[model samples]
Target: MFLKNAWYVAGWDSELVGDALLARRLLGTNVVFYRGEDGTPVALEDRCCHRLAPLSHGQREGNCVRCMYHGLLFDATGRCVDVPGQERISDKLRVRSYPLVERDHLLWIWMGEPSLADPAQIHDSHWHDAPGWTAERGGYIHYKSNVHLITDNLLDFSHLAFVHNKSIGTRKQGGVKPEVTFSEESVSVRFTTIEGAPPPFARQLSKLPDLVDRFNFYVWNIRGNYFAQDSVIAPPGDGYGSQSPLAMKLHTFIALTPADEGSSHYFWSTAHNDFTTDIVDVTRQLTAQVTAAFEEDRNIIEAQQRSIDASPGAPMIAIAADGTLLRIRRMVDGMAAAEQARPVEQTLVFQPAARV
Candidate 1:
């Protein structure tokens, strides 16, 4: 049920340090990750070739993993290199090794053809490391709901009216009809509120007039990436001083990776280009606010998942606000379908675990 050929964020780049083995289930496969001697990340199937023992529970000997169960050792390439008693290793004694790359503190893995794995295809989250931007540390979260449910929530911000009433959005802003546009790889939605009150979060950034102008834009891709740009400014004649923070800008980045049919992984962070403020303290406060906002969303999405489970046969009614969400669903469904229709020879099929 997942797009295996696509790149998925396995975890943080710093997570796999000093022979640490991070085992994660992505797209229904149990994969183990570790940092090699060269500090490069390596992903291998979690199950050991012999006795099906979990290699994640094994010890790392240099760049190879030694199965604590029977002393079977596997290299970073997932090839069986040593056996406790046997001198010769079978050519088939190996586990599937996935292509993994580390960039911008994120570890991305490719589960399909290793030949087609390209680092350029990975989403550019460079803003996390960009100059003049203060970004909070990246958050690696888990959700008990399907990836699509989370995507649906991210693609439609109209829920901000009722869902995030206390934090980031107002009723009028939620009611505003965004200009929705589609591209080959993503969908974009944008809207602006003139002479409207800023969200509660914006008030923390600066003392401004009761009324402000707000511009919001969001883009979502089928690979489960969401990029948002939000700007708020006080009226020009409001007599807000130069020292008074009158303008606020925020950028949010989110990436989703399906864990299985019932759960998903979330990688996110928020960055701002407010040089006038104390970036260190502002980032801390912003991180807390953004975390609270997402927690609210998490509660709602989990509740929706329970509701969906209760009424699996019922069809959801799409409203005018569902324009972007619906388009996202279409694109995801189309890509998944296309992947399934590809030639059989190009598909990766696994052999049965040999009983040793």
Candidate 2:
């Protein structure tokens, strides 16, 4: 039930800093990623086309991979260039080479039909590297749960009341009605608490008075997980939804990537403007506090996964607040359904050549 023609975050660029073979299971496919001397990243099927040995366990020869099992050498493009004790190399002797693109310090891999992969469609996570902003302390966390469940959790933020009470949640967020909106490309659910007290931790450094305006928002796009927490504190009655030059502001960015059905990868970073140095500093340095909230998220999601594993078909009810989550689920399910039904004619046209 996965969409093949999409870009998934393989990993952070920092993970591949050195010449190392990174092994990861994405959407149930074993992929091995490594860097060529030219600093280009390459991804190929982890299994050798010959003896089914894992290339990750093999050695790198320049930009190529040597499957030590039978000494078959595959170039970065996944074409077999050499075979020990043999002079003939067949064009059929190659493993899949997935499309890989690096942008904004994140490595995005396309795991579906190679012909349909478009770098332009990779969702822009530009907030991390946008000019005039400071993106701090990018972090990664691994979770044991279906990626969809995590998306469901993010699509609806009402869980913060019980899950993140100690870290960033206040009772006020539980009562605010979220504005959910959608289009062909994305879905957003936003909650605004007018003149309500800010999260306990945020109040420490905020110049904002006891009663100020704040918002929590979540976004789901075609190919990536995204959400934000924003605060632009204007006095209770002065105004709302507009930024003031003197107002203190806050912004946090969170994104997710899937590894497999039973597990997933999480990537996150926080960014802020110059308006409130003190408040932003608290967010920057109290990353652990922020992390704790996510850990709380993990605890709940993993438990839910266990329940789902035991009874996958069990019905889960949706509430009024679930309008966005339902739409998000439908969007992904729709894309996957469409890909599954891709015409046979379109697929057969791309089939490999017959053996000579």
RMSD of 1: 4.8
Tens digit of per-residue lDDT, candidate 2, span 275-295: 553554564555666677788
Q: Distance (Å) between predicted and true CA of 174, model 2?
A: 0.9
Residue-wise C-alpha lDDT for candidate 1, range 252-340, written one tens digit per residue: 87888888999989988778766344344777787788898899999999999999999988998887777667767888888888877
Best by TM-score: 1
Worst 10 residues of 2 by lDDT: 347-356
lDDT of 2 at 30: 93
Task: List CA RMSD, all candidates.
Answer: 4.8, 4.4
**Model 1 poorest ten-residue lDDT run:** 347-356
Error of 1 at 260 (Å): 0.5
The alpha-carbon lDDT assigned to residue 33 of candidate 2 equals 86
